[model samples]
Target: MQLQKLLSLIRQAVDRYNMIAEGDKIAVGVSGGKDSLTLLYALKKLSQFYPKHFTVCAICVDLGYDNTDFTGIDEFCRNLDVPLTLISTQIGKIVMEERKESNPCSLCAKLRKGALVDEAVRLGCTRIAYAHHKDDFVETMLMSMIFQGKFYAFPPVTLFEDKNLRVIRPLMLVEESQVKGFVKRQEFPVLKSPCPIDGTTKRAYAKELVAQLQREHPGTKERLFHAITEGKIEDWALPGV
Candidate 1:
Protein backbone atom coordinates (compact mmCIF):
# COMPACT_ATOMS: atom_id res chain seq x y z
CA MET A 1 0.00 0.00 0.00
CA GLN A 2 2.99 2.25 -0.39
CA LEU A 3 2.57 5.32 -2.57
CA GLN A 4 4.73 3.90 -5.32
CA LYS A 5 2.79 0.65 -5.52
CA LEU A 6 -0.51 2.51 -5.34
CA LEU A 7 0.56 4.78 -8.18
CA SER A 8 1.56 1.78 -10.27
CA LEU A 9 -1.87 0.20 -9.86
CA ILE A 10 -3.60 3.48 -10.66
CA ARG A 11 -1.52 3.93 -13.78
CA GLN A 12 -2.39 0.44 -14.91
CA ALA A 13 -6.11 1.14 -14.64
CA VAL A 14 -5.79 4.51 -16.33
CA ASP A 15 -3.76 3.08 -19.20
CA ARG A 16 -5.99 0.06 -19.64
CA TYR A 17 -9.14 2.20 -19.78
CA ASN A 18 -7.71 5.24 -21.55
CA MET A 19 -8.94 7.24 -18.60
CA ILE A 20 -6.67 10.27 -18.96
CA ALA A 21 -5.91 12.42 -21.96
CA GLU A 22 -3.73 15.44 -22.46
CA GLY A 23 -5.08 18.56 -20.71
CA ASP A 24 -7.77 16.65 -18.86
CA LYS A 25 -8.94 18.26 -15.62
CA ILE A 26 -10.33 15.65 -13.23
CA ALA A 27 -12.55 16.52 -10.27
CA VAL A 28 -12.01 13.87 -7.64
CA GLY A 29 -14.97 13.14 -5.34
CA VAL A 30 -13.43 13.18 -1.88
CA SER A 31 -15.78 11.95 0.83
CA GLY A 32 -13.03 12.48 3.42
CA GLY A 33 -12.77 8.70 3.66
CA LYS A 34 -9.65 6.65 3.29
CA ASP A 35 -10.37 5.49 -0.24
CA SER A 36 -11.12 8.91 -1.64
CA LEU A 37 -8.24 10.54 0.24
CA THR A 38 -5.92 7.83 -1.01
CA LEU A 39 -7.17 8.49 -4.50
CA LEU A 40 -6.59 12.23 -4.16
CA TYR A 41 -3.09 11.64 -2.83
CA ALA A 42 -2.21 9.10 -5.50
CA LEU A 43 -3.64 11.13 -8.34
CA LYS A 44 -1.85 14.25 -7.14
CA LYS A 45 1.41 12.34 -7.13
CA LEU A 46 0.58 10.72 -10.45
CA SER A 47 -0.17 14.06 -12.07
CA GLN A 48 3.30 15.20 -11.09
CA PHE A 49 4.83 12.90 -13.70
CA TYR A 50 2.02 11.25 -15.65
CA PRO A 51 2.78 11.44 -19.38
CA LYS A 52 -0.74 12.54 -20.26
CA HIS A 53 -0.42 15.64 -18.05
CA PHE A 54 -3.73 15.85 -16.26
CA THR A 55 -4.64 18.12 -13.35
CA VAL A 56 -6.76 17.08 -10.33
CA CYS A 57 -8.94 18.83 -7.77
CA ALA A 58 -11.06 17.54 -4.87
CA ILE A 59 -14.84 17.88 -4.41
CA CYS A 60 -16.99 16.77 -1.51
CA VAL A 61 -20.81 16.91 -1.46
CA ASP A 62 -21.78 17.77 2.09
CA LEU A 63 -25.14 16.16 2.86
CA GLY A 64 -26.24 18.90 5.28
CA TYR A 65 -25.57 16.92 8.38
CA ASP A 66 -25.08 18.73 11.67
CA ASN A 67 -21.75 18.80 13.51
CA THR A 68 -19.84 17.58 10.47
CA ASP A 69 -16.54 19.36 10.31
CA PHE A 70 -14.55 19.55 7.08
CA THR A 71 -11.59 21.44 8.50
CA GLY A 72 -9.37 18.37 8.40
CA ILE A 73 -10.27 17.72 4.77
CA ASP A 74 -9.59 21.34 3.93
CA GLU A 75 -6.11 21.14 5.40
CA PHE A 76 -5.58 17.73 3.81
CA CYS A 77 -6.26 19.15 0.35
CA ARG A 78 -4.16 22.24 1.02
CA ASN A 79 -1.24 20.04 1.92
CA LEU A 80 -1.60 18.15 -1.34
CA ASP A 81 -2.01 21.41 -3.28
CA VAL A 82 -5.31 20.24 -4.72
CA PRO A 83 -8.21 22.67 -4.88
CA LEU A 84 -11.16 21.53 -2.77
CA THR A 85 -14.86 22.30 -3.20
CA LEU A 86 -17.50 21.59 -0.61
CA ILE A 87 -21.06 21.65 -1.95
CA SER A 88 -23.66 21.91 0.75
CA THR A 89 -27.04 20.29 0.11
CA GLN A 90 -30.25 19.28 1.89
CA ILE A 91 -29.97 15.70 0.68
CA GLY A 92 -29.92 14.33 4.23
CA LYS A 93 -33.11 16.10 5.16
CA ILE A 94 -34.87 15.24 1.94
CA VAL A 95 -33.99 11.58 2.08
CA MET A 96 -34.30 10.94 5.79
CA GLU A 97 -37.05 13.41 6.68
CA GLU A 98 -39.25 14.34 3.75
CA ARG A 99 -39.24 11.18 1.71
CA LYS A 100 -38.64 8.88 4.66
CA GLU A 101 -38.00 6.03 2.29
CA SER A 102 -37.17 2.77 3.99
CA ASN A 103 -34.06 2.49 1.88
CA PRO A 104 -32.47 5.89 1.61
CA CYS A 105 -29.12 4.96 0.16
CA SER A 106 -30.40 4.93 -3.43
CA LEU A 107 -32.10 8.31 -3.28
CA CYS A 108 -29.36 9.85 -1.20
CA ALA A 109 -26.72 8.62 -3.61
CA LYS A 110 -28.55 10.00 -6.61
CA LEU A 111 -28.87 13.42 -5.02
CA ARG A 112 -25.24 13.46 -3.90
CA LYS A 113 -23.92 12.29 -7.27
CA GLY A 114 -26.14 14.72 -9.14
CA ALA A 115 -24.72 17.55 -7.07
CA LEU A 116 -21.18 16.33 -7.68
CA VAL A 117 -21.72 15.99 -11.43
CA ASP A 118 -23.36 19.40 -11.77
CA GLU A 119 -20.52 21.05 -9.92
CA ALA A 120 -17.89 19.18 -11.88
CA VAL A 121 -19.50 20.37 -15.10
CA ARG A 122 -19.71 23.93 -13.81
CA LEU A 123 -16.01 23.75 -12.91
CA GLY A 124 -15.23 22.76 -16.53
CA CYS A 125 -13.84 19.42 -15.54
CA THR A 126 -13.59 16.78 -18.23
CA ARG A 127 -13.95 13.86 -15.83
CA ILE A 128 -14.89 13.00 -12.23
CA ALA A 129 -12.89 10.47 -10.30
CA TYR A 130 -14.69 8.18 -7.85
CA ALA A 131 -12.68 6.13 -5.36
CA HIS A 132 -14.29 2.78 -6.04
CA HIS A 133 -11.69 0.06 -5.69
CA LYS A 134 -11.49 -3.68 -6.47
CA ASP A 135 -13.63 -4.67 -3.47
CA ASP A 136 -16.30 -2.16 -4.35
CA PHE A 137 -16.28 -3.46 -7.89
CA VAL A 138 -16.90 -6.99 -6.69
CA GLU A 139 -19.55 -6.07 -4.11
CA THR A 140 -21.47 -3.93 -6.57
CA MET A 141 -21.56 -6.75 -9.08
CA LEU A 142 -22.86 -9.09 -6.42
CA MET A 143 -25.45 -6.59 -5.30
CA SER A 144 -26.70 -6.14 -8.85
CA MET A 145 -27.09 -9.86 -9.42
CA ILE A 146 -28.78 -10.48 -6.08
CA PHE A 147 -31.08 -7.49 -6.00
CA GLN A 148 -31.59 -6.45 -9.62
CA GLY A 149 -31.19 -9.76 -11.38
CA LYS A 150 -28.35 -8.54 -13.58
CA PHE A 151 -24.70 -9.32 -14.01
CA TYR A 152 -23.60 -5.73 -14.21
CA ALA A 153 -21.02 -3.62 -12.45
CA PHE A 154 -19.97 -0.10 -13.28
CA PRO A 155 -17.29 0.23 -15.89
CA PRO A 156 -13.91 1.69 -15.07
CA VAL A 157 -14.62 4.65 -17.35
CA THR A 158 -18.19 5.87 -17.86
CA LEU A 159 -19.13 8.66 -20.24
CA PHE A 160 -22.03 10.97 -19.54
CA GLU A 161 -22.58 12.18 -23.08
CA ASP A 162 -25.39 14.61 -22.29
CA LYS A 163 -23.28 16.38 -19.67
CA ASN A 164 -20.04 16.11 -21.65
CA LEU A 165 -18.40 14.59 -18.59
CA ARG A 166 -16.90 11.22 -17.79
CA VAL A 167 -16.56 9.28 -14.51
CA ILE A 168 -13.28 7.48 -14.00
CA ARG A 169 -12.11 5.03 -11.32
CA PRO A 170 -8.35 5.16 -11.17
CA LEU A 171 -8.27 3.00 -8.05
CA MET A 172 -10.16 0.26 -9.81
CA LEU A 173 -7.06 -1.88 -9.51
CA VAL A 174 -6.40 -1.18 -5.83
CA GLU A 175 -7.92 -3.11 -2.94
CA GLU A 176 -9.93 -1.58 -0.11
CA SER A 177 -7.57 -3.06 2.47
CA GLN A 178 -4.66 -1.42 0.73
CA VAL A 179 -6.45 1.89 0.76
CA LYS A 180 -7.07 1.60 4.51
CA GLY A 181 -3.43 0.75 5.04
CA PHE A 182 -2.28 3.67 2.91
CA VAL A 183 -4.39 6.22 4.72
CA LYS A 184 -3.51 4.85 8.14
CA ARG A 185 0.20 4.69 7.35
CA GLN A 186 0.29 8.22 5.98
CA GLU A 187 -1.77 9.49 8.95
CA PHE A 188 -4.01 11.36 6.53
CA PRO A 189 -6.96 13.16 8.06
CA VAL A 190 -9.84 10.73 7.61
CA LEU A 191 -13.41 11.77 8.39
CA LYS A 192 -16.27 9.52 9.36
CA SER A 193 -19.29 9.64 7.10
CA PRO A 194 -22.09 11.86 8.36
CA CYS A 195 -24.89 9.59 7.26
CA PRO A 196 -27.17 8.30 10.03
CA ILE A 197 -27.10 4.78 8.66
CA ASP A 198 -23.47 4.59 7.79
CA GLY A 199 -22.89 0.84 7.68
CA THR A 200 -26.33 -0.79 7.67
CA THR A 201 -26.99 -0.55 3.95
CA LYS A 202 -27.41 -3.36 1.44
CA ARG A 203 -23.94 -2.70 0.14
CA ALA A 204 -22.59 -3.39 3.61
CA TYR A 205 -24.32 -6.72 3.61
CA ALA A 206 -22.80 -7.52 0.25
CA LYS A 207 -19.39 -6.53 1.55
CA GLU A 208 -19.68 -8.91 4.47
CA LEU A 209 -20.90 -11.68 2.19
CA VAL A 210 -17.97 -11.14 -0.10
CA ALA A 211 -15.65 -11.26 2.87
CA GLN A 212 -17.16 -14.51 4.05
CA LEU A 213 -16.72 -16.03 0.61
CA GLN A 214 -13.13 -14.88 0.52
CA ARG A 215 -12.49 -16.42 3.89
CA GLU A 216 -13.98 -19.71 2.77
CA HIS A 217 -12.23 -19.60 -0.57
CA PRO A 218 -9.32 -17.31 -1.24
CA GLY A 219 -9.09 -15.31 -4.48
CA THR A 220 -12.87 -14.90 -4.56
CA LYS A 221 -12.57 -11.19 -4.98
CA GLU A 222 -10.10 -11.54 -7.79
CA ARG A 223 -12.41 -13.93 -9.61
CA LEU A 224 -15.35 -11.57 -9.23
CA PHE A 225 -13.28 -8.65 -10.54
CA HIS A 226 -12.11 -10.78 -13.45
CA ALA A 227 -15.71 -11.60 -14.26
CA ILE A 228 -16.60 -7.93 -14.22
CA THR A 229 -13.77 -6.85 -16.55
CA GLU A 230 -13.70 -9.85 -18.91
CA GLY A 231 -17.30 -11.07 -18.77
CA LYS A 232 -18.24 -9.04 -21.87
CA ILE A 233 -21.00 -7.20 -20.03
CA GLU A 234 -22.56 -4.33 -21.92
CA ASP A 235 -20.68 -1.04 -21.72
CA TRP A 236 -17.92 -2.91 -19.94
CA ALA A 237 -15.71 -2.74 -23.00
CA LEU A 238 -12.71 -0.46 -23.11
CA PRO A 239 -13.25 3.13 -24.12
CA GLY A 240 -13.74 3.56 -27.92
CA VAL A 241 -13.57 -0.17 -28.46
Candidate 2:
Protein backbone atom coordinates (compact mmCIF):
# COMPACT_ATOMS: atom_id res chain seq x y z
CA MET A 1 0.00 0.00 0.00
CA GLN A 2 2.93 2.29 -0.37
CA LEU A 3 2.77 5.16 -2.81
CA GLN A 4 4.52 3.13 -5.46
CA LYS A 5 2.04 0.28 -5.44
CA LEU A 6 -0.91 2.66 -5.22
CA LEU A 7 0.32 4.64 -8.23
CA SER A 8 0.90 1.46 -10.20
CA LEU A 9 -2.67 0.32 -9.74
CA ILE A 10 -4.07 3.77 -10.44
CA ARG A 11 -2.04 4.06 -13.64
CA GLN A 12 -3.31 0.69 -14.74
CA ALA A 13 -6.95 1.66 -14.35
CA VAL A 14 -6.38 5.05 -15.96
CA ASP A 15 -4.66 3.52 -18.95
CA ARG A 16 -7.15 0.72 -19.37
CA TYR A 17 -10.08 3.13 -19.52
CA ASN A 18 -8.46 6.04 -21.43
CA MET A 19 -9.50 8.22 -18.57
CA ILE A 20 -7.22 11.20 -18.96
CA ALA A 21 -6.38 13.44 -21.90
CA GLU A 22 -3.75 16.06 -22.50
CA GLY A 23 -4.35 19.30 -20.56
CA ASP A 24 -7.46 17.85 -18.91
CA LYS A 25 -8.40 19.15 -15.51
CA ILE A 26 -9.84 16.55 -13.11
CA ALA A 27 -11.77 17.39 -9.99
CA VAL A 28 -11.29 14.77 -7.31
CA GLY A 29 -14.41 14.46 -5.15
CA VAL A 30 -12.90 14.59 -1.70
CA SER A 31 -15.17 13.08 0.95
CA GLY A 32 -12.37 13.53 3.51
CA GLY A 33 -12.37 9.75 4.04
CA LYS A 34 -9.46 7.40 3.67
CA ASP A 35 -10.34 6.32 0.16
CA SER A 36 -10.83 9.83 -1.20
CA LEU A 37 -7.75 11.13 0.56
CA THR A 38 -5.72 8.27 -0.83
CA LEU A 39 -7.04 9.13 -4.30
CA LEU A 40 -6.13 12.77 -3.87
CA TYR A 41 -2.61 11.82 -2.90
CA ALA A 42 -2.24 9.23 -5.62
CA LEU A 43 -3.49 11.52 -8.36
CA LYS A 44 -1.27 14.35 -7.19
CA LYS A 45 1.73 12.06 -7.29
CA LEU A 46 0.71 10.62 -10.63
CA SER A 47 0.40 14.06 -12.17
CA GLN A 48 4.05 14.61 -11.51
CA PHE A 49 4.99 12.26 -14.36
CA TYR A 50 1.82 10.74 -15.78
CA PRO A 51 2.83 11.54 -19.43
CA LYS A 52 -0.71 12.77 -20.10
CA HIS A 53 -0.12 16.22 -18.54
CA PHE A 54 -3.41 16.49 -16.72
CA THR A 55 -3.98 18.65 -13.63
CA VAL A 56 -5.97 17.74 -10.51
CA CYS A 57 -7.90 19.67 -7.87
CA ALA A 58 -10.28 18.65 -5.10
CA ILE A 59 -13.98 19.37 -4.55
CA CYS A 60 -15.66 18.58 -1.23
CA VAL A 61 -19.43 18.69 -0.78
CA ASP A 62 -20.02 19.61 2.82
CA LEU A 63 -23.36 18.20 3.99
CA GLY A 64 -23.99 21.07 6.45
CA TYR A 65 -23.45 19.06 9.61
CA ASP A 66 -22.57 20.91 12.79
CA ASN A 67 -19.12 20.71 14.30
CA THR A 68 -17.78 18.96 11.21
CA ASP A 69 -14.29 20.26 10.72
CA PHE A 70 -12.52 20.45 7.33
CA THR A 71 -9.38 22.18 8.46
CA GLY A 72 -7.33 19.02 8.20
CA ILE A 73 -8.54 18.43 4.67
CA ASP A 74 -7.79 22.01 3.73
CA GLU A 75 -4.25 21.67 5.01
CA PHE A 76 -3.85 18.30 3.33
CA CYS A 77 -4.73 19.77 -0.05
CA ARG A 78 -2.57 22.79 0.57
CA ASN A 79 0.42 20.61 1.29
CA LEU A 80 -0.21 18.67 -1.87
CA ASP A 81 -0.36 21.91 -3.89
CA VAL A 82 -3.93 21.12 -4.98
CA PRO A 83 -6.75 23.61 -4.85
CA LEU A 84 -9.79 22.52 -2.84
CA THR A 85 -13.30 23.81 -3.50
CA LEU A 86 -15.94 23.09 -0.88
CA ILE A 87 -19.63 23.22 -1.80
CA SER A 88 -21.76 23.65 1.29
CA THR A 89 -25.35 22.35 1.26
CA GLN A 90 -28.14 21.56 3.71
CA ILE A 91 -28.42 18.03 2.39
CA GLY A 92 -28.10 16.66 5.91
CA LYS A 93 -31.09 18.66 7.12
CA ILE A 94 -33.23 18.08 4.04
CA VAL A 95 -32.72 14.35 3.78
CA MET A 96 -32.39 13.33 7.41
CA GLU A 97 -34.56 15.80 9.28
CA GLU A 98 -37.09 17.38 6.94
CA ARG A 99 -37.72 14.42 4.63
CA LYS A 100 -37.20 11.83 7.40
CA GLU A 101 -36.39 9.20 4.84
CA SER A 102 -36.60 5.60 5.92
CA ASN A 103 -33.95 4.90 3.31
CA PRO A 104 -31.86 8.08 3.13
CA CYS A 105 -28.70 6.88 1.47
CA SER A 106 -30.17 7.03 -2.03
CA LEU A 107 -31.49 10.59 -1.87
CA CYS A 108 -28.48 11.83 0.03
CA ALA A 109 -26.08 10.42 -2.56
CA LYS A 110 -28.06 11.95 -5.41
CA LEU A 111 -28.04 15.39 -3.83
CA ARG A 112 -24.36 15.22 -2.97
CA LYS A 113 -23.33 14.15 -6.45
CA GLY A 114 -25.50 16.78 -8.05
CA ALA A 115 -23.83 19.43 -5.97
CA LEU A 116 -20.37 18.03 -6.76
CA VAL A 117 -21.02 17.89 -10.51
CA ASP A 118 -22.28 21.46 -10.59
CA GLU A 119 -19.14 22.72 -8.96
CA ALA A 120 -16.96 20.71 -11.26
CA VAL A 121 -18.71 22.25 -14.22
CA ARG A 122 -18.32 25.74 -12.79
CA LEU A 123 -14.62 25.10 -12.37
CA GLY A 124 -14.37 24.01 -16.01
CA CYS A 125 -13.18 20.56 -15.18
CA THR A 126 -13.36 18.00 -17.95
CA ARG A 127 -13.73 15.06 -15.58
CA ILE A 128 -14.42 14.06 -12.00
CA ALA A 129 -12.66 11.25 -10.16
CA TYR A 130 -14.55 9.33 -7.50
CA ALA A 131 -12.80 7.18 -4.92
CA HIS A 132 -14.66 3.96 -5.60
CA HIS A 133 -12.22 1.09 -5.13
CA LYS A 134 -12.55 -2.63 -5.79
CA ASP A 135 -14.52 -3.44 -2.63
CA ASP A 136 -17.08 -0.77 -3.39
CA PHE A 137 -17.49 -2.13 -6.91
CA VAL A 138 -18.11 -5.65 -5.60
CA GLU A 139 -20.43 -4.47 -2.85
CA THR A 140 -22.45 -2.32 -5.23
CA MET A 141 -22.84 -5.23 -7.68
CA LEU A 142 -24.05 -7.41 -4.82
CA MET A 143 -26.50 -4.74 -3.75
CA SER A 144 -27.88 -4.39 -7.25
CA MET A 145 -28.37 -8.14 -7.53
CA ILE A 146 -29.99 -8.60 -4.11
CA PHE A 147 -32.14 -5.48 -4.05
CA GLN A 148 -33.00 -4.86 -7.69
CA GLY A 149 -32.78 -8.37 -9.20
CA LYS A 150 -30.13 -7.33 -11.70
CA PHE A 151 -26.44 -7.94 -12.27
CA TYR A 152 -25.28 -4.35 -12.47
CA ALA A 153 -22.38 -2.26 -11.31
CA PHE A 154 -21.15 1.14 -12.40
CA PRO A 155 -18.49 1.21 -15.07
CA PRO A 156 -14.96 2.53 -14.60
CA VAL A 157 -15.75 5.46 -16.86
CA THR A 158 -19.09 7.19 -17.44
CA LEU A 159 -19.78 10.19 -19.62
CA PHE A 160 -22.40 12.79 -18.79
CA GLU A 161 -23.09 13.82 -22.36
CA ASP A 162 -25.45 16.61 -21.45
CA LYS A 163 -22.90 18.17 -19.16
CA ASN A 164 -19.89 17.43 -21.36
CA LEU A 165 -18.16 15.82 -18.41
CA ARG A 166 -16.69 12.41 -17.80
CA VAL A 167 -16.63 10.55 -14.45
CA ILE A 168 -13.62 8.36 -13.95
CA ARG A 169 -12.61 5.87 -11.27
CA PRO A 170 -8.83 5.66 -11.23
CA LEU A 171 -8.77 3.80 -7.95
CA MET A 172 -10.98 1.05 -9.37
CA LEU A 173 -8.09 -1.38 -9.30
CA VAL A 174 -7.14 -0.75 -5.67
CA GLU A 175 -8.79 -2.55 -2.78
CA GLU A 176 -10.24 -1.06 0.40
CA SER A 177 -7.63 -2.90 2.49
CA GLN A 178 -4.81 -1.28 0.54
CA VAL A 179 -6.43 2.11 1.00
CA LYS A 180 -6.52 1.60 4.78
CA GLY A 181 -2.91 0.51 4.84
CA PHE A 182 -1.91 3.50 2.72
CA VAL A 183 -3.69 5.88 5.05
CA LYS A 184 -2.12 4.30 8.11
CA ARG A 185 1.34 4.29 6.62
CA GLN A 186 1.12 7.92 5.52
CA GLU A 187 -0.60 9.05 8.75
CA PHE A 188 -3.18 10.91 6.64
CA PRO A 189 -5.97 12.70 8.41
CA VAL A 190 -9.37 10.99 7.94
CA LEU A 191 -12.51 12.80 9.05
CA LYS A 192 -15.29 10.84 10.65
CA SER A 193 -18.51 10.62 8.64
CA PRO A 194 -21.33 12.71 10.07
CA CYS A 195 -24.04 10.38 8.79
CA PRO A 196 -26.13 8.90 11.58
CA ILE A 197 -26.28 5.49 9.91
CA ASP A 198 -22.75 5.44 8.57
CA GLY A 199 -22.15 1.71 8.90
CA THR A 200 -25.74 0.48 9.17
CA THR A 201 -26.71 0.89 5.53
CA LYS A 202 -27.38 -1.84 2.99
CA ARG A 203 -23.90 -1.36 1.58
CA ALA A 204 -22.46 -2.22 4.96
CA TYR A 205 -24.42 -5.44 4.96
CA ALA A 206 -22.94 -6.35 1.58
CA LYS A 207 -19.44 -5.54 2.81
CA GLU A 208 -19.93 -7.81 5.81
CA LEU A 209 -21.35 -10.58 3.63
CA VAL A 210 -18.41 -10.30 1.26
CA ALA A 211 -16.02 -10.54 4.18
CA GLN A 212 -17.78 -13.60 5.53
CA LEU A 213 -17.73 -15.27 2.15
CA GLN A 214 -14.05 -14.54 1.81
CA ARG A 215 -13.39 -16.05 5.21
CA GLU A 216 -15.36 -19.22 4.34
CA HIS A 217 -14.16 -19.38 0.74
CA PRO A 218 -10.85 -17.82 0.00
CA GLY A 219 -10.49 -15.98 -3.33
CA THR A 220 -14.18 -15.18 -3.40
CA LYS A 221 -13.56 -11.45 -3.54
CA GLU A 222 -11.00 -11.73 -6.31
CA ARG A 223 -13.24 -13.98 -8.37
CA LEU A 224 -16.19 -11.66 -7.97
CA PHE A 225 -14.13 -8.69 -9.14
CA HIS A 226 -12.76 -10.66 -12.08
CA ALA A 227 -16.25 -11.73 -13.05
CA ILE A 228 -17.49 -8.16 -13.01
CA THR A 229 -14.68 -7.10 -15.33
CA GLU A 230 -15.02 -10.08 -17.69
CA GLY A 231 -18.69 -11.05 -17.28
CA LYS A 232 -19.85 -8.98 -20.29
CA ILE A 233 -21.97 -6.83 -18.02
CA GLU A 234 -23.10 -3.70 -19.84
CA ASP A 235 -20.58 -0.84 -19.56
CA TRP A 236 -18.19 -3.04 -17.56
CA ALA A 237 -15.86 -3.85 -20.41
CA LEU A 238 -12.68 -2.03 -21.38
CA PRO A 239 -12.58 1.00 -23.66
CA GLY A 240 -12.34 -0.84 -26.99
CA VAL A 241 -13.91 -4.07 -28.25
Tell me, by lDDT, which candidate is best.
Answer: 2
Q: What is the TM-score of each predicted model, taking all chains together?
A: 0.98, 0.98
Give the local distance difference test score of model 1: 0.92
Residue 99, candidate 1: alpha-carbon lDDT: 100
Q: Per model, how many backbone clashes are there? A: 0, 0
Query: Which regions of candidate 1 fall more than 4 Å away from where they truly are?
Result: 238-241
Candidate 2 stretches with Cα past 4 Å from truth are 237-241
lDDT of 2 by residue, 1-241 (tens): 7899999999999988898988899999999999999999999999999988989999999999999999999999999999999888999999999999998999999999999999999999999999999999999999999999999887998888899898999999999999999999999999999998999999999999999999999999999999898888887554511
- RMSD of model 1, in Å? 1.1
Cα-based lDDT for every prediction: 0.92, 0.93
